[model samples]
Target: MARPNSSPKASISPQKKNSSSPREADFDIQQELSRLQEVIYESFHIPVSRWTIIDEDKVLEQLEFIGTKIPEAIRKALQVLEQKQEILANAEAYAQRIIQQAQEEAAEILDESGIIQQAQHEANQIRQQVQSECEAIQAQTMAEIEQQRQMANGEVEQIYRKSVSEAQQIQEGADEYADAVLTRLEQELGEMLGVVRNGRQQLYNHSAQRQTNNSGKQLSEG
Candidate 1:
């Protein structure tokens, strides 16, 4: 027996439904860079006489990963910018078409031989109406373009600020960690020095006692 036909909707892939939208796919490159910075900061060890130690290979690996992601983010942003430009271009083209059509209609009305005054008045009215419509369209288009531009700028600024804040936090955490490590190291070194000094004092006393005993034996023998 022949099987029934499947619906068109049923043939759609599930992956497409789960995929992220264009706006959602636009990632913050600065944030990713900041995360890389944080990782590097966290990996660093306390400075030893002006030299801080870290895993160079691991840091390089993290930087490479970030490098791979940056281009993708930049591409997404460029795509968004292109989309905005296309929208503006389309709007301007539509406005031009409307204005051209209005002008043609007005010219046709003015070309009529009989009822010249009526034709002239009607043409003037048409011109006024088309001018107002053109102005309105231009204003609306400009508004939309400005709004989109502001939104894009705001998004970029927000990303930059967030990255800066994250970087600052990473720096603070690393500084605190280094300070703690250094403090512990200093305490340990101080204890070691104290132990060495005590050992030297003990050795000096023992040597002096031995010298005095030898001197007493020599005097008694004489």
Candidate 2:
């Protein structure tokens, strides 16, 4: 037997649904772009994207990490600045000390230079005085030496003249004494010769008288 004819719509739901306009998908693109970077970061560790919607507790933890690191970086920068200030202060003090030392040394050099100049001037004055005195004494000494030489020359000439006169007188006296002795010897020799001649004449006269008497006696005998 054939079944009674059935409608195609019998298995479908019996309630009628109203259809006017389909609802459109509402999306915030700016918000999605802002969370894109966070989504990439979370995907590295958690394997979840912010586009998939994250939990409130995870976002709070990321904000706390950034806050703590900022204060620590600021503290380190302040410490470096303080150290540089101390180094600059020390350099300034050293420069001042060097300048003071140079000024004091310059003053001392000027004082010593003045003292040396004064001493040189005094030495020049004393040297001039001594030179004048020496010249005067030299002149006096030359005059005394000349006077003594003249007196000695005069005494020597007088002594030479007296010695020559005494020698001449002695020579004359010797010649006169020799002449007187020769005269006395010649007179004594003449007197002795005259006495011998008279004796011989007397003997001759006696012999002649004796011969004459003999001749007379012979004539008488004849």
Candidate 3:
């Protein structure tokens, strides 16, 4: 059988037509997700704390743009990520500045024991970690640095107390040694005095005996 001259026209999908958007894919989960992230970034963060500070109105307005025409929204999301990177870079610079300041202060505390030097070394290590994981670092940065500072201070206190105790023990031991030596010297001097007294008594007794013998002989001669 012969088909009709007018064939059924191919129906085009409206969804397919829009899929070729220059910026946003028609149903891109990634684009939607990025838009959501941008919205959040535009909504909440602290400036002084070295993080984002987003506006609520802007957050809501941008969120409304999701699932619809999202080309502009995705662009903004990319911008937000870049801004985050910039903020992170600024934070790293600030951290380095603080480290330099701390190093200068730590120099005064470091001595022959090098206890504070160890603390500074650990601080530098922390700074390195921050640099390595900058994208992931957050509020915990302050806490970590503070904890290290407290630990350093505690170590210094412990070293000081230990040093004082050892010094006192040394002084006490020296005093005891001196006392023992003096006691021995006194005993030896007493023994020498006794020997001198015995020798004097023997000499006196001999002289008296000799005088008596001489007197007796003279009497016999008379």
Residue 115 of model 1, lDDT score: 35
* TM-scores vs. true structure, each candidate: 0.36, 0.28, 0.29
Across 1-222, the per-residue lDDT of candidate 3 in tens digits comes to: 111222222232112223447443443434544554544443444444545555556556645655354444334333332343344556566656655665565455343233455656655775676466554543443443344335444453333324334435534543453344335434533443344455556666888999999999999999
Question: Candidate 2: which stretches are off by over 4 Å?
Answer: 1-40, 44-50, 113-222
Question: Any idea what lDDT model 1 has?
Answer: 0.48
**Predicted candidate 2, C-alpha RMSD:** 69.2
**Residue 212 Cα positional deviation in candidate 1, in Å, after optimal superposition:** 99
RMSD of 1: 43.3
Error of 1 at 53 (Å): 2.7
Least accurate stretch of 10 residues (summed lDDT) in model 3? Answer: 1-10
Taking the tens digit of each residue's C-alpha lDDT, what string does model 2 give over 135-209?
453454345335433543444333332333433443343234223322332342233223323433444466566
lDDT of 1 by residue, 174-196 (tens): 34543543454345435534544
- Order the numbered candidates by lDDT, best leading: 1, 3, 2
lDDT of 2: 0.37
Alpha-carbon RMSD, each predicted model:
43.3, 69.2, 30.0
